[model samples]
Target: MLGKILRIIGIILMGLASALMILGGIGTVCIAWFPENWESLAMMAPYKLIFQTAVIFTILAGILGFWATIKLARRKPNGWNMAVIALLLSLATAGTKMYFSNMARGSVAPTNMRFYFSLFVLLYFLALRIPAIWDKIRFEGDQPDEGVGGLAGGAAAIVAGGLTLTVHLWAGPSHTVNGINYVAYLQTELLAAGVGLIIVGLIPLALDLWKTAVSRHTSETLKIPVIDNRA
Candidate 1:
């Protein structure tokens, strides 16, 4: 009964996460892409490229999250793995946002609340891995869990970050296109470099996090029928 309750709560949290990602991504893209007036224009002019790139990642995460949620609802085999992915992406973004925002403000007292909230939810998600919960959620099928086999995301991040930094160097600090706020580091081409590095760093960290979370209670230790959740 407790497992069932936790499962229900997890689904609700998952759905909320998906909706927030989609809505927030779209809103940010609209504002940054179409700056309505001078204030909005000035706000996004410097870091528009970063905003655009993150927006792409955000939308993808949201879509995958929704797909995974549907799969879970239907007890599909791939749902477990997909949910892990969606949660990882969401964690990456939340951490990056919190880091950059704190850096910009030069204070950590009042951080982006999403960071803490996402982390708590992530831990809660991990706690739901009890065998009883898994017995309820896991369907009989192939568990295509290749958590360590793939470096594609990390390699892609490296290339993107390297290219961004290269562009930043080539741009030569001349007005950040010499059009808008060309001088500020946080608001100029430098921001792209920062965001790019964050992406590069976070991918592996998220992967490691996933590995650690799923490895906590193996069949050997739990003494039950193992439903491999490492994906």
Candidate 2:
């Protein structure tokens, strides 16, 4: 079970991290280079470069997180340490962006997906270190099928994709930029979240299906050795 859980985590982090890296990089570049053209971005004109650097760090942290997850799947000794670093970096990035963005926009609260997921995953790691919980998780660690995780991961990806899209649709195209730029509605965070989920979900889900198919094919085609005892 632990093994399968590790694999699922690996699949989820790698795919999500890859997607975030691409999107975050592009967004940072766009914000820095074309702040004037965007109403929301324009607000950060003075701090465009700052936000860009923060975003870059976030992307780097995500990459490290991906590497850490891979190491964990392989049962590397330093996997947890590396994960600690990645999660801290991610938390720092989230805090920095939220703090500065809120100050700039005159908002008291601001949040991002990175903030929520990193914090939760990190907390989970801490909880696992407890002897009692670790016992349960490791009870059937050596058992096969451990397949509950794979199914859960797939179902979660689908559900996340569906919910995000639903919210995006429900929100409609009507975003407000400090009482201005109605056009920002077309480019809302919900829209980005929905699209990101769809794209990110495709990676792990496709890989899961592909592996299942190959495994089935190999099982069907493989020949077993047989011997006959004759008098």
Candidate 3:
């Protein structure tokens, strides 16, 4: 019962996080296209600060969702693995972004550092998705406990990471101006990362639905014994 309750709560938190991600994505995309709009809003410094506060809140909510899932998964083997990987990926991505942001602000050109950090974030995102894919395939009762789904998911992640790395390698370095443009770039990346996270966050809920359906079916099929067998 506790597990069920926690799982439900985790799902709710994950959904909330996903919604925030979508909002953040939309906001970032809008800002990217209309940089001038932000300039005008910049005049209202307090409003701009409020917007920043919202962004931070959104990030914190996402982190909380991930942490909640991790906590709920403590006893469940597969779920635990998924939660741990997701949490680690989230942290690594955040760390890499911070590192790159600092590098972009410093006097020296940290092109290599930036590239590698981006690659690291990409890899972490890919790794995080593995558990989602595994959850999908392992939902069925007939499936063996051989961990095949996880291995397949890991392979898929490897391919994804490789592709992202290729794109990073081909992409040119972003220009920075007083760290303003760097901030914009970081926001853009965060938006993209949020989208990825939103997708991952949805997976567990979908898996839970699938599991509930299976359980209901199984329960309905089971026959209850009475003193006498009656129609």
Would you list the C-alpha lDDT of every candidate in the order shown? 0.53, 0.58, 0.39
Q: Residue 52 error for model 2, in Å?
A: 2.1
If the candidates were sorted by their TM-score against the true structure, best first, what order would they fall in?
Answer: 2, 1, 3
Please list the residue runs of candidate 1 whose C-alpha ends up more than 4 Å from where it truly belongs after superposition.
40-43, 101-113, 136-231
Candidate 3, 1-231: lDDT as tens digits: 332333343333333332333233233332234434554323334333333444454455345544444433332345434434443433443344334434433321222333343344335334434664435433224534343332223233233333333332322233333434433444555446545644554564466667779989999889686686584
How big is the positional error of residue 148 in model 2, measured in Å on the Cα after superposition? 10
Clash count list over all predictions: 1, 0, 0
* lDDT of candidate 2 over 1-231, digit per residue (tens): 564564455445443433343344444455456679766667868877777787787778767875665555444556666777877877777777777777776642223555666677777667666776555443223455334444544544454555545542332222234666343443576467766766765666577788889999999889687777784
Model 1 residue 145 lDDT?
Answer: 24
Give residue 49's lDDT in candidate 3 (0 to 100). Answer: 35
After superposition, the stretches of candidate 3 with alpha carbons farther than 4 Å from their true spots are 1-13, 18-46, 75-231
Report the error of model 1 at residue 58, Å. Answer: 0.8
